[model samples]
Target: MDSLDLEVLTRARAWLDDGHRVMLATVVRTWGSSPRPPGALLALRDDGRAVGSVSGGCIEDDLIYRLQRDGMPESPQHVSYGVGAEDARRFGLPCGGTMELVLEPLRDAAPLDALLARLAAGELVERRLDIASGRSTLAAAHPEQGTAFDGETLTSVFGPRYRLLLIGAGQLSASLARIAQGLDFAVTICDPREEYREEWNIPGTTLTREMPDDVVTAMRPDARMAVVALTHDPKLDDLALMEALRSPAFYVAALGSRRNNAARRERLREFDLNAEQVAALRGPAGLYIGSRTPGEIAVSIAAELVAVKNGVAAERVLKVATAKAALDIAADTLSACATR
Candidate 1:
């Protein structure tokens, strides 16, 4: 779950604690061009107070109106919007988009408190809600498992939040860490260099002076994790890459020029990494966005990170080196024409 979903849980617990009846709305399924994805959350208090979102405000408005007029439902019920063209126009759904939602009125907060505790403790949990009984349970879950609906029951997976292990604590790393936190990734920055470690002031991310390789080992990067090397120091970056490339991390990248990355790959082969593991390294991290400053580079890196997280093919992404090379050639051509 992302930040908004987390907020929904927080607000729901608050409302329930305040002796108010709360309805939890979840986007169970979506079709066409819906605004939010499945598993997005929205919570509405009996007094019309709400947190989170489902659609582009239209669905939320309708939900509030219904609650205000009809009062909270006695039991969990499935509701949908934008089922037809006219319905889409009425709800302001884009291009006849549709979404199915499960609305459960909550009168208990014990299960919710337990689930939130597990999430805070860095545990992935599966929450199963029985629509008819209004009963729910939380069990341990895997990172790859997602929300599932089986007609009568809705099983939604909560945290162990996605993590990002950054192998540096510099300006670029700081910027990237900030964005990663906003994207709901638990970011950790590792740097053994005293100067860099002393200067690091990124608040949300955990900063460590431990060896990069040891940090990577402790992380035990899973499919839900990503590792990026921004240190630009082969001594530090290479060892970390050696471990990360062989780990289960879904995305592993390093920041460098194309030529430098080729050299880095050659250097990695001399270490403990096998050919296959070395081949897994994604150097020259980020897309080809013609980025010249630290902030721009951070954006490019975050963009590629998101693309990989979404399972986008590597070949489909354009690299910074390729774009920079094209620009250099264009500049050279223009300069020659001017001289002539």
Candidate 2:
């Protein structure tokens, strides 16, 4: 689940505690070109206040209007939008897109509180809701399982869907952690240096004083995981990369300039890693965003990470290395012309 949906649940629980009637909406399915995917959440209050989104804007507006005019349903109900071309245009759905949503009125906050607690404990939870009874059940969920609905019950996966391990606890890592958290990534910061570890202070991230290699080994990074080495020290970064590259981690990156990255790749080749493993290393890890500060660099790295996670083609993304090389060539050309 993304942070936006998590916020919906958090705000819904708070609203229920404050004696406000709240209805939770989840996109169960989409036909074509839908703005929100299946399992997207929207929490609507009795007064038409909402926390999340279900569509671009018009569908949400229609939902709010319905709440104001008709009132909340007594039980869970499934609602759909964009059934035809006219309705699609009216609801701002593109290409006649259609989406089905399951809306459940909240009578109590216990289930939500329980689900949130499990998520806080770093567990993936599957929540099943019976449409007729309006009761819900929670269980452990496999990483592969996603939101599913069959006419009667709706099962949705809730919690952080991706994990990020940053092999440094410095300013760059701190900024990246904040951005990753907002993107609903479970972030872990590993640093063996007591000097750096003691100064680390970031909430919603796991901080460890263990060696970077040990942390990576223990994590056993899978396809849904990413490993980034922000520490400039080869002693700390190289070992982690050696282990991460050999694993199934979708992204294994290090922070450095082009020359430094080239040297780092050479150093990794001396280890047990093969040429293929060393080639997987994404050095100067970020898009070509011309970022200079730690915050801007964090944004650039996060953007690249998201693009990779979504399976965007490498040729489609402008990488920092490729862009910087072009810029260097252009600068040399300009300097030569000036001298002439």
Q: Which candidate is the best by lDDT?
A: 2
Question: Which lDDT tens digits does candidate 2 get at residues 1-340?
Answer: 9999988999999999998999999999999888889999999999999999988988888889989999999999998899889998898776577899999999798888999999999999999999999999999998889999997999999998899999989999999999999998999999999889999999889999999999999988999999999999999999999999999999999999999999999999999888999999998899999999999999999999999999999999999999999999999999999999
lDDT over C-alpha atoms for residue 184 of model 2 = 82
- Give the lDDT of residue 165 in candidate 1: 92
lDDT score at residue 105, model 2, on the 0-100 scale: 93
- For 1-340, candidate 1 gives per-residue lDDT tens digits of 8878988999899889999999999999888888888888999999999999988898999999999999999999999899888889988775567889999999998888999998787678899999989899989987778878777999998874689999988999999998987787988899999999999988757889999999999988888889999988998999999899989898899999989999999999998888888878877899977787999999999999999888898689887767778888999999999999
Clashes (backbone N, CA, C under 3 Å), per candidate, total 0, 0
lDDT of 1 at 18: 91
- Considering only N, C-alpha and C atoms within 3 Å, which residue pairs clash in candidate 2? none
Q: Which stretches of candidate 1 lie over 4 Å from their true place?
A: 94-97, 198-204, 272-276
lDDT accuracy of residue 53 in candidate 1: 91
Find the candidate with the highest TM-score and give its number.
2
Model 1: ten consecutive residues of lowest lDDT: 90-99
The lDDT for every candidate, in the order shown, is 0.89, 0.93
